[model samples]
Target: MIKLQVIGNLGKDCVVNNVNGKSVINFSVAHTEKFRDAQGNQKDKTIWVECAYWTDRTAIAPYLKKGTQVYVEGAPDIRTYSTQDGRQGASLSLRISNVQLLGTRSSDGEGGSSYNSGPSYSAAPQHVSAPPSSSQLNEPADDLPF
Candidate 1:
């Protein structure tokens, strides 16, 4: 089995469609890469990935708008086709299995908050919930489970 995961900002708003009684939400994520070229020129390459999330609940469609950052994991599908000009082109798409609402505007917060939860990816990743301090993560040699 092959799995792919991508974390990036949404390129455009999502579309919810009802196909054969199943709800499907379609969106796209833009993953970018920055590197130096052979001539020592910095180049930025962005790849767009179309994602389809199939679920019974269409409740989250409203929040899955443009610029909303998302983390998606699923199977990668590379589709090839000929362009109108007879040129060849390919697109990247994903069949999503999991979708999580990281954050949303104050009114759209998944969990009620004093104020709407802001952006989810603006900050670096870390353990935010109340938990034992780092000491627990760096415990001395112990005998529990290897």
Candidate 2:
């Protein structure tokens, strides 16, 4: 069995469909790779992956909106077909076994999510009491024959 994992922003809102009485959520994830060419020119290449998550837990569909970052893991499949012009086209798709929302893009197109607008951390850690010293070790080891 082959497994694939992808972390990227959603291309569009997820859609839930019922086929043969089974619910499936469909969405797309786009991953962009950045690199420099031989001439030191920066370039980016984006790969789009279609996902189909079959589950009864469709509650998560609402959160799978456009620009929402997510992590998905599943079985990968490549589909190839012929276009009307006799050209071959291929797409990478996944049958999602698990999906999780990572964050969301701010409305102002900022780099962070509004979900994290509040305090970035919790209260400071409390100091813990020190352990017992050697002198405090169990009545100085009572002598006993094993």
Candidate 3:
């Protein structure tokens, strides 16, 4: 089994469709990478991935809006097609098995706050312990061998 994981922002709002008695949520994600070329010139490249989440759980559709950050994991599918000028092109798509909402972009195109619960499409809420208090941090390490 080949699994692919991606963390990026959604390019547009998701669409939920009912096909043949099944529900599917379609969306796209864009990931950008920055690197220095041979001449030491910095460059940025962005890749867009089409995603399809076929599941009965459609409650998260409303949150999958444009500029929303998400972490998606699934089986990847590469498709090749002919362009209008008879050129071959390839596209990357995913059969999403899991998705998590990270954050949303602010109205001014700046960073925004994250979701408090951090809900996942295919899993339940995980237990996350709170950070240690100042007193706890100041305590001696009684179990240390040193």
Candidate 4:
């Protein structure tokens, strides 16, 4: 019943795989923290989280590219194994329940653009249908003197 959420930039493009008739998207996210060390020296540490999203909705997979920011939530999992040098190492992974793209690094390499799952803003009106004609009226207008 433990849940974890991470907001960070994608390390690379997502991979969509078909395993036993089920589709799964795999990706990695990196979060960096900045702090001042004991000697007043600035330091940065990065944490990488591997994510696996199993769902039929693969439309979002195309957009999960490198340097793309996203928010992901899911059940946390820790995997421990022995490295090639006979050293024990552990990695953090998640079975994603939900994910959202936050932004994308701009093509110009200057900044980035924000993203929203909701509808975009438009200056024009959405409904363009005309009003009902007199023949379509259910009831006549009330006739009264001013």
Candidate 5:
């Protein structure tokens, strides 16, 4: 079995459709990487991956909006097709098995709300704990021997 994992932002909102009584959510993710070429020039390359999640868990579909960051793992597939100009092209696609929300990009290109799809596959806000206080940090360690 082959699996692929991707961390990127969604290009657009997800669409939920029922195909013969099975629910499928379709979306796309864009991952951009920055690298310096042999000439010492920096360049940004973006890869777009189409994703399809076949599951009864459609509760999280509303949060899969454009510019929303996510982590997805699934089986990868490459599809080839002929372009209008008679050129061959290929696209990457995924059959999503697991997906988690990272953050949302605001209109100003900044991070906004964040969520996570927990075990139940529900869209819920993640819990963040505060750092320990100075007094707590000064406490002695436990008496457990090494």
Candidate 6:
């Protein structure tokens, strides 16, 4: 029941590796944060997460390039190791089960659609009725603007 969801920008181009007749794609993503401190000073921070997606749909590999913003969900794995400087380090890794392509190239200045544009937007009118039939259209023109 360990589930993790991450939304971030790809850190580098994804690589596909084949081992034991299975395909695995490895990629890293960076998620940034911006916040105001106690003094109202702006601050920014970024978190990096490693993801491994094992799927036969290698077609998605090319799209998982650097700078691609994506949403991934899966189980989390934390590992600790000793660094060369005799310091202990731990990293957060994810074995992604579901990956969604979020947006297009940033250089193009046109990103992908967010859920805001979908039918679920609250501002949109609910259950728009269909146009009137010919009977309703037969009504005499009451407007004098014509």
Could you estimate the TM-score for every candidate? 0.69, 0.76, 0.79, 0.76, 0.76, 0.72
Shift of residue 89 alpha carbon in model 3, Å: 0.5
lDDT of 5 at 78: 100
Best by TM-score: 3
Query: Over the stretch 18-117, how does candidate 1's per-residue lDDT look in tens digits?
Result: 9998899999988888999999999999989999998876777887876666788899899999999999999989999876655443446544333334
What's the candidate order when arranged by decreasing lDDT?
A: 3, 5, 4, 2, 6, 1
Root-mean-square deviation of candidate 1: 9.2
Clashes of 6: 0
lDDT of 2 by residue, 24-120 (tens): 9999999999999999999999999999999998878888888888889999999999999999999999999988777777777565445432111
The list of candidate 2 runs beyond 4 A from truth reads 108-146
- Computed on alpha carbons, the lDDT of every model, listed in order, comes to 0.78, 0.86, 0.89, 0.87, 0.88, 0.81
The most accurate candidate by lDDT is 3
Give the Cα-based TM-score of candidate 4 against the true structure.
0.76
Better of 3 and 5 by lDDT: 3
Evaluated at residue 114, the lDDT of candidate 5 is: 44
Worst window of 10 by summed lDDT in candidate 4: 114-123
Clashing pairs in 1: 106-116
Model 4 clash pairs are none
Off by over 4 Å in 4: 111-146
Give the alpha carbon lDDT tens digit for every residue of 6-76 in model 3.
99989999999999999999999999899999999999999999999999989999999987889999999
Task: Identify the runs in model 3 with alpha carbons over 4 angstroms from their true place.
Answer: 108-122, 126-146
C-alpha displacement of 26 in model 2, angstroms?
0.3
